[model samples]
Target: MKAFAQVFACLFCIALAGVSVAQDAASSTLTDAEQAFVDQMTESVLVGQFSVDGRSDRAPKPERYSIQSVTKTSDDNWIVQARITYGKYDLPVPVPVQVIWAGDTPVLQVTDLKIPLMGEGFTARVMFYKDRYAGSWYHGKVGGHMWGSIERQSPDEGSKTPESESSESDE
Candidate 1:
């Protein structure tokens, strides 16, 4: 697992570098709606709760993801800069995702992406519409459903400390 983590970290860094280059050469081909989606996601936070499968008796756990920015590189490619803080690790991750629209809604698609400190085999279909978000996630043997509201983050709130950050993306 440690070796896998190291390799994943290296790959993630390389992907981020490519994303940066792609962002620079990106054309202004985004539709009005896509631009709006990017604007809305800038400095936003998805504050909501998540449920663990087979744990119906337990209350849904709170989760918040702070998105510093979202940039479209191509027709369906986007990079979301998200600050992930777990335990003593706090790092800004440039998550490259594919965005498919459901009418005017944007759904972020991630498949088997390995994130540093978040483990491998992570798959999620998180959608954003209006000011709400809902998604299904699968990480290894644990899977869950998440839904929440999108809120603008204040300048002072760079990042909120999680109640209990988990290694899972559910955090």
Candidate 2:
């Protein structure tokens, strides 16, 4: 009886260990290098003095762009789920785009997009995918809604805090 119990306990522990490792890998935070890529692309999109720069103004300006969730769907890709509110109405729009690293720059390309660019009572679904290249990885100017795209990143990302945190305090 003691032997059997010991075996069962060992197996149970091993299973739990496996599960924990998987969760970590699945929800793995973006590496330092990856975050840098996201930052650069975002900077590129910021238009200064209506300069017609990358595409910030033309990108529909989703009200809130803080990434809500991220899941690793593959080795080279991540499924980035974000809730975007557009315009004064601040309507709830969920957009999931794919992000990957190309060379030193992290490329935020669109795997799929959905938007209604038509008349009232109109609905649109965009399965648009952007194939961009730049330096080492992506070319550039890949997928997006309205106009442009950048790999979204939360501010105060690199700190000694937990992963499931906003890194912001009530101000």
Candidate 3:
């Protein structure tokens, strides 16, 4: 009877440890403020202008980005799925960026982020606040500034479908 009691006590401790591990895993999700930021950014549109280096004389045209989703993988990292329209090309890319906070503001930072067919020198540090975002971008030797407002898209605003996924725009 003494040996049986020892074995049962050991088994009970092991079960408690397993439950603790499971609870820890369940608590690894983002906090409330982080979730709020993610909710505001998802399914939003960024409308802005970008300029190339040494081209200050030309007027900056309109640039548009459709933010499809934002998924938080960890406390400070997130993956953003976006459709970027440049000139006549529409590129859908998954951008992994780091989120840092300055007081109550959230900033998205990307360092040397490479996009397929868009080269490997892309870098951006953008801050989002009050429905607005402003940032600077670098592409190899050419660098520029971008600032825009976030517009939430309604369900009837012609969002991109899965069948419309392509490297080039249909228009």
Candidate 4:
């Protein structure tokens, strides 16, 4: 009976140690810079314009990305939960992107990512610096350049539609 008790206690201690290791890993996974980026992007809006490669005559269309959250899943992987409002479509998508750094700047890369209603073979390389982001995006044969400013949103403000966001951008 005493031997059995000792074995059970050892197993319990090992389980507790495993939980502690997991907690430590979870807490320390993201570096300070990465955590700051996550904080900056959560509940924020990217308001900007996108230009098609051959559509110079057409005015750049208004674009808005309402970020619900940005979470780092691994060293180079992040999931950006954002509501994309552009053209006539509004979609809330959890975008899995690869993050690579250039010095202190973090660039988000999406290669041939397909979202429902958006079609397939979508690729983009976007980088953030301070309060702005710029990138090139490709979908099928249509590709373009996109640039925009990031605006922090209050929790109660809620996400805006393209028309409403466009009006604000016009001002």
Candidate 5:
């Protein structure tokens, strides 16, 4: 009976230690302010302009990106679930990116990150400030610049189409 009780105590201590490690691991990666910024940016839309390299004659129009969520995985990495629409292609994907902090500002850095269905050689370094964002993107041999304003979708606005959102921004 004494030996059995000793073994049970050792196992209990190990289980408690495991729980402590798991709790530490579950702690957030972002600071209070940084997490606040991320919370505000999520479930928002980015209205911006994207110009393809060597496409100088193309008219500049606003583009829309629907951000669903942003989850911090590590000290410098986050997973962003967003819907991106370009030309005839629309894709909703989760993109893992690195976040670099300049004071309180957060900049998302992607180096040669590839989306599964999308073409490879895709890279972007985007910075978010207040309600605005600007970035540069590279796709294979083509690259361009993009910047936009972050807009929160109203309850009614969420069900509306992107076209309607674009028009609302115009107004």
Candidate 6:
């Protein structure tokens, strides 16, 4: 049984590596327009950076629990730094996030259970322009199958998806 457990562990590790690679690839891809936006973002990063102010809710985010931090590491990868609030709570608590940038702007994939009623979830906003996705990152396993990463995104053409106010302008 010990050998069986060891083999299972090895298989799980290999599978995790595969998942990370796949996740990174999926997040980095972009549509022409999105790519344009990302390009602008990268340029802005070169110039310094912008900002993604505030925050909003994400619909049916792939995540299944409480959120930690939202980080945009690469043009394609975004990391959520936290552990699943319920289900099988892991030790050391890791940072879980939704990988974005591929075809869609990654949003908060989970809600904070600590919030009252609505959980006042992910009111945070992130605007990353340039970031180092290719580097050693914090990695851990969740649900015994999924993997998580913690990284940073450099901001460029800063944007806030959630706005506190709006102006009526004649078009």
Give Cα-based local distance difference scores for all models. Answer: 0.65, 0.29, 0.55, 0.61, 0.57, 0.26
The CA-based lDDT of model 4 is what?
0.61
Q: Which stretches of candidate 3 lie above 4 Å from their native place?
A: 1-28, 84-92, 156-171
lDDT tens per residue, model 4, 29-136: 777777667767777777677777888888776565667667666678767666554446554566676778898888888787765654557677888899998887
| Clashing pairs for predicted structure model 2, backbone only | 37-106, 102-137, 103-137, 132-138, 132-139, 133-138, 133-139, 133-140, 134-138, 134-139
Candidate 3 on 1-171: residue-level lDDT in tens? 222222211111111111223224533575766666767776676656555557778765444556666666666766676654433444455666777887777788777766555456556677888888777666556666667787886674334432242223435
How many clashing residue pairs appear in each of the predictions shown?
0, 10, 0, 0, 0, 19
TM-score of 2: 0.32
Output the better candidate (1/4) by TM-score: 1
Q: How well does each candidate superpose onto the true structure, as a TM-score?
A: 0.79, 0.32, 0.68, 0.75, 0.70, 0.21
Cα lDDT tens digits for candidate 6, 1-171: 222222222221111111234334544654554444333332121111111112123111111122223334455344333222221223212233333443444322322312222122222222233331121111122111222232222341123111111121112
Highest lDDT model number: 1
Question: By descending lDDT, how would the candidates be arranged?
Answer: 1, 4, 5, 3, 2, 6
Tens digit of per-residue lDDT, candidate 5, span 103-122 = 88777777766655444455
The alpha-carbon RMSD values of the candidates against the true structure, listed in the order shown, are 6.3, 18.7, 18.8, 17.1, 17.4, 17.7
Position 112, candidate 2: lDDT: 20
Instruction: Name model 5 segments beyond 4 Å from true.
Output: 1-29, 84-92, 156-171
Tens digits of lDDT, candidate 2, 1-171: 222222211111111111223325754465766444333333121111111224454523211123334344455544433322222222222333345545454444432233332111111121212322221111123222222232434454322122123233212
> For model 1, which pairs clash?
none
